[model samples]
Target: MAKADITLRGRNYSIACAPGQESRIVALAGQLDARLQHIASAVGDIGEDRLLLISALALLDELDAARRTARPSPEMERKMAEALGAASDRIEALAARIESGG
Candidate 1:
């Protein structure tokens, strides 16, 4: 395990992660802190817990929007389906030829 110190809202917290994941954890904490700061600026000095809550909700909203937009479109889905169907047909034909001892 690895330990890292992260600062958020002017407070320091120690976090532990897998040996190689410390950098990733630190980076994510930075993102969270940035979001917290942004929220605090907009709604001046609403308690820490409230600020954290709002930041978490805001981050989740952003994640949901990204997921929705990143999903495969209808055209992409159609192309994938066509590709899979072609591969399946080739496999079945190969199996049939083997069964016939040719």
Candidate 2:
């Protein structure tokens, strides 16, 4: 894992992520900062905490919308199929053993 020092609203914070994913984490943080600022500026000088909360909700709404369109990756689909096939075979094997009075 790696961590990056990020500054949002003039405050510095450390964020950690899995190896090779620092870029994505940082980019997401940047988007959050921008969204928060947008919220703060939109309705006039709302306090930082309130602004952050509102922005969080807005971001979560966006995430929920996108989740509706997300699909499993090809690798995940293949692995899932393999696992299902293995489970089916195990169940069939047990059924045969039980039927044969073993």
The local distance difference test score of each candidate is 0.92, 0.85
* Candidate 1 local lDDT, residue 96: 100
Q: Could you say which candidate leads in TM-score? A: 1
Worst 10 residues of 2 by lDDT: 35-44
lDDT per residue as tens, model 1, 3-102: 9889998899999888988889899999989988888999998899899889888888999999999999999999999999999999999999999998
Winning model by lDDT: 1
Cα lDDT, model 1, residue 2: 89
Candidate 2: which stretches are off by over 4 Å?
Answer: 68-102
All candidates: CA RMSD (Å): 2.3, 7.6
Q: Distance (Å) between predicted and true CA of 67, model 1?
A: 1.6
Clashing pairs in 1: none
Pairs of colliding residues, candidate 2? none
